[model samples]
Target: MRKTLEEKLVPPVPPAVRRAMLDAREALPPGGADVTARLFAAMKENRDAPTLPSSKSFRDAAASESTFRTLLRCLARYAPHICTSNAVTVSEEWYARRPKHVTMGKSTPVQPTIWPAAWRALAPALDAAPIKQSSKRRYRASIDRCAAMVRAGRASSDFGFVAAADLADAFLFNADATARVKPITAAGYLDGLIALGRFGGIDRVHLLPMQLVAEDLREQAAMMPKNKEARIGAFMERGGFGYAADRIAVCLRRAESLPVHSAAGRRALQTAMVCAVFMNKPARKGDMVSWRIGHDIVRQPNGEWSLAWQQGKTGKNTEAGVLWPEVCYILDLWILGGRPDRLVYHRYHELEGLFLLSQSECQAYRNLPSELTLSAIGVPSHDLRTAAADYMRHYDPEHAANVISAHLGHGSQKSGEAYRSECSAAAGQSEWQRSRMIWS
Candidate 1:
């Protein structure tokens, strides 16, 4: 008789060993549960295995190279006694032997550009242009898309040459069908084409039409409502800044009581710290990730915490005054308690001074706040900065301009105009409501 799938999955280990594996599984983050279970099952099946299964055996069972590495880390943390001294070394060697630059899963074949001759003709001019390398890369990508469109018979072709019409047609392809061209994307595409024309030494008289189209696109983009405005308004309407603050406070409280070694607890503490810093300082994402303990974030003699960093965008030295006490408390808990416990086993020394240790952790720090709030607030992390500015404008209208400029590291007071306008609109709406109530 054939065994059931559930029966096959169950590890045929002794009761004591099974219980130990279950306990170790609980310490793992939610995503690690399945992989950890599989590891234990493999261990139970191999009677010759004293500790972990061989690297080759485990690699066969793993979904991907990334997953195999993740499982190894989990074992090192939760069941370190079972992991051999050379476990990580063996896994690293196995990873190194795998094919380079080759994606694991089924991948779409690369499509050759239709106008190779045109691209070859344009490549030299683009490379030699005295523009930023980033700009050159953007132009090359835009030209590639134009060539693809022409190949697909979706855009005009001028005797196998890519022209302005083809560039415009490529912009409208919507090839992915996921979203239409956003105003900002349209602007980027137009800019790339303009730069390409100049680099190709096309006559200004012939380029006048493309330049005019670029200006029109910029006008349309300016007229469109700002995403920050919409996000701020939605977040404010749904209990505003107070709601996000309350959520962070709840996470911190829960995290404080849980064991530092618990992955879920460490995650909760990290999320609270991320949201709190953004709420108080409103720094850009790059600065937040790059922040170091003794350098960018510091504690003063008065026992208050302050943050100062050279702004990545503007290259200006910006600093924020003492953070809120709640923010400071969460930071202390994470730095002193949760962080060290989490990183002790792996890559701790390499990532000692950084605020966020890994890309996955950084993404979670940026994303989890919004998830916890049910997407009603703090989406994209930057929205927290906008909310902070909006709250000041609404409550402390007199100091809103200067305060926002300083608090958000904005280069000029004019940047606070949108927040001020939002406050005025809300105030006018309130007055209209009160007038109706009196008349009624």
Candidate 2:
């Protein structure tokens, strides 16, 4: 009744490759694709069964049973007929729209404007970043609606794109209002405040701190149990202030010279740094944090590495595990600060977000565009992992999937596919965009 993938077919491993894998594991790293390849090869030649991640890691990667089903699809692609699946009808499928509208249509060849898309990118910063209690369901509804619209031909590639050749208006978003273009009234600000108190985190729509909600948030935070710091961090991040947590993580990483003498900075720094450590482990931030374990990281007889807490923002479910070097560096930094057991990345997340906010505060004093300042890096904390994926792909096309999957702690490979975020990195982005306009 139960057919194990490992029991089926195996890939042949040469002695030379085995030696290479052992050498690399001892010297270079453990999760290197070469090691994985060698292990697969050995399984074929010697009929040696494969290793698995600790159950804790696997559970972390698979937040729910449905998520595990998705993992089966990824496995089938990577290793054909390796895993089994229970097929469900297409009528059972559903969709969910994300944070905002995504327009995918035929390209009419709009030229890139002289204005940097950087400011538009930065528009998400400030008091505007907010997600509501009702928002997620609304978004999910939107996706379902979008799917139906597509199927009915109400919206399709034929619907076409905006005709503007330039994006002088893209930066023109309603910051003081809902993303729906409504003016941000007192009620809107209040709605944002309630959401923040309910969901605080970097990804939260309510990114900025509110003078009115300050006391309320503090009271709410104080009542949360000490062990539930993960939830607290999520609340902050979900409110669009997760970056603040990241800054705190950065501070913890380099806590040696941080000016503790500055009262506000020290307090904010300490709070953010501590949160990053707790929040770094997998969990969604809202009223509370919930942790899950997956099969991949389970300590089964076949599992290889020991299970440890993950540092992915989307929790273990969507994001893959951190790279060994990156994880080690984070741990070493934590040890240096005499806070080895403390949650490191959550602190970094807090520190990073606070630092950005402080920088924006300084910018506000000068009346400069803080949005432009934030987008200078062109990406966020998580993009570094995707950047790493792109870097790996740049180095090798074939082995990119395995290394990226292990690195990001994902149960599957879709995130790696979504790594094509950068315009230049996308397959067809250059087809229409020209570096030179032939001015001569």
Candidate 3:
């Protein structure tokens, strides 16, 4: 009798190992099951023995390096006993031995363009300007981009003199052409020009034109509707803040019940804490990721949790007082129970204070909110601010603007209004009327 297709694909492993792999296939997500099967087949091809091959051998047999990584994660989750080699070590080795193809079929390397003389001259001034390190980097990048645009348009080698006209031309080129830039990006380049003008390097008279253009660009960008109303409606339809809070509580409970060493438990704890923090206080993603224990997050004398940080965008001192008890509880669980287990021993000294340890971990936390909710209320982490703003506006019309200004770390009350949904106005009016009747 001829062998079936499934039998032909099955690797010659022990019955027990084969059973574990079969269970893994059943347990894993659709994509993950495929990856697991590929991993098993690769292992069989690399060695004659029924025993698992070295990580390097498996990597060699993998279709791509990413596939090898997925296999490692699958092994860690479903068949940990069989995975003896350290995943991190194998990853480092794979990275080190990755094919170093200098040219992709006779392609020459593109060298970085040297900074134009005008930008180079202003570099020292930009560095010395009492601005944040991040801002300085952004301004420098904008200058480089603007210079490239100018060089591409003009034939002059002495593209050393940057002026208001040049910047306006660049903006127009980016706004109306094939290589168009976003309005926000154009605003950034204009900011770079304004900075240069303020440094006394360029003519101060040029400042007005750049500022006006930047303002118009910003207004236009803001006026372009993003279908936020539909998203907000969908979010509220799914029980809004109440539903999210309930889900977070469930995640916290699950985390607490699972063993301390469980990676799934750690992730659940992380997701709960992140959602709680964002729910109580909607902060910028950068601020959320960069939160250090003692500095940004602190325990007050009254035993209430407090957050204090300078807003990265507006550079304003922002503070949130006495967070929700649920938020505080989850923070405690993460700090006392979860974070320590997740930290690598050697790197503990360096990363112990950071709330979200690394960029990858931060990304995972950001992604968890949507995944946990089954994509019913999908929104980026930043959109949490809008949600909070809309919720506040609905409940309290008079105080919402002021509260939103402080809650979201906005520079002014006017800035807070940008986050308010159109529907919130009607909701706020009805709530205000109900409040009047109750008080009357």
Give per-residue CA lDDT, model 3, range 1-440, as digits (tens).
86432453355434554566565544654344455555566666766333334555565545566776666655556655443222333565568776555576664667675666766777788889888887887787777666776677732222223444465456656555776766766777767756755673666455666677778777766877666667767777878788778778788788766644355666677777777788888787766766666567775444467788887778888888778876776776665443332332322333346564231223233334444333323555566778887777766766677777778888865675554444466567787888999999
Candidate order (TM-score): 3, 1, 2
Query: Model 3 clash pairs?
Result: none
Put down candidate 2 lDDT per residue, 1-440, tens digits, no spaces: 64332322224533443444344434433223333343344335543323222223333334344454454333333333221111111101212212234347543464432212322233244225464424543333333322332344333311112201011011123232332211222223333323333342323333233323334434554565543234334433444234544554555444443322223333334333224322333222221112121222211222221224433333443432442333334333432232322334433343332222121112122111122212322222343344445556555544556655665566555554554334225434443344334432
Better of 1 and 2 by lDDT: 1
Please give the CA lDDT of all the candidate structures: 0.61, 0.33, 0.62
TM-score of each: 0.58, 0.25, 0.59
**Which regions of candidate 2 deviate over 4 angstroms?**
1-254, 258-378, 409-440
lDDT of residue 260 for candidate 1: 45
Backbone clash total, candidate 3: 0
Q: After superposition, how far is residue 157 of candidate 3 from its true place, in Å?
A: 11
> For all candidates, what are the clash counts?
0, 81, 0
Question: Which window of ten consecutive residues has the lowest lDDT sum in model 2?
Answer: 163-172
